[model samples]
Target: MLQMLHEKGLRAEHCYAAGIASIGAAFVSWMLSQRMESNGIARADRWGIFIGEWAPTFIALGNGLRTYEK
Candidate 1:
């Protein structure tokens, strides 16, 4: 998908970077939740999962855009 976006002259790099960043954020959220002293661990997990969901869409959009360009 990234390759297709790159070929289509879209800034696939940024899309890829955003996906990576989202995953990082999700990981951090999960870690923080685990380290928390309160009962917010589940909240943190949910937040991480929610944020993690976005990565795939961004990737898909990038891929779709690339395919459309082609």
Candidate 2:
């Protein structure tokens, strides 16, 4: 999968950027959920957590891609 991704032009920088973006997205999602939904803090927390979970995977992928880059 890493080989294929590299072949297709996937890069570490892209994953790093996405990971960073997801961090902000998590905050945005939480705020939006808090204001736009009537479900309260618990629901907003879940929304933020779900999006925040993506960052680790993206950062890990970036590290793996960095190996390919080297």
Candidate 3:
């Protein structure tokens, strides 16, 4: 997968940027859900947590891509 990603021109910097963006997106989604839903803060928290989980995967991918680049 890493090889494929590298071949596709996905650099470590891209993944790192994605990771940071996802974190911000997660926070935004949480706030949006909180304001728009009746399920309240719990639902918002879950939304935040779910999106927040993607950051690690992106960061890990960034690391893997860095390795491949080397």
Candidate 4:
């Protein structure tokens, strides 16, 4: 999968950047949900946790791609 992604021109840097971006996005989503929803903190926490989950995947992909780059 990493090899295929590399072949498609996806690089480690891209994944690393995405990981960083996802973190920011998670925070933003949490804040937004907290502010906008009537459902309160639980919903906000869920939103935050859901988006936060993407960071590990991107970071892992970045690591894998870095290996392929070698």
Best by lDDT: 4
User: Alpha-carbon error at 68 in model 1, in Å?
Assistant: 5.3
Candidate 4, residues 1-70: lDDT per residue as tens digits?
A: 8999999999999999999999999999999999998998999999999999999999999999999899
Once fitted onto the true fold, the runs of candidate 4 whose alpha carbons sit more than 4 angstroms away are none
lDDT of 1 by residue, 1-70 (tens): 5565567677645666788888998898888877883776778788789989889977776666655545
lDDT per residue, candidate 2, 4-63, as tens digits? 998999999999999999999999999999999897899999999999999999999999
Per-residue lDDT value at 46 in model 1: 87
Full-model lDDT for every candidate: 0.75, 0.95, 0.97, 0.98
Task: Spell out the clash pairs found in candidate 4.
Answer: none
Worst-scoring 10-residue span by lDDT in model 3: 36-45
lDDT of 4: 0.98
Model 2 ranges off by over 4 Å: none
Q: Is candidate 2 or candidate 4 better by lDDT?
A: 4
Q: What clash pairs does model 2 have?
A: none
User: Candidate 3's error at 19, in angstroms?
Assistant: 0.2
Candidate 3, residue 49: how far the Cα is off, in Å: 0.5
Candidate 2 clashes: the total is 0
Q: Report RMSD (Å) for each prediction in the order shown.
A: 4.7, 0.6, 0.7, 0.5
Model 2 C-alpha RMSD to native? 0.6
Task: Go through the candidates in order and give the clash count of each.
Answer: 0, 0, 0, 0
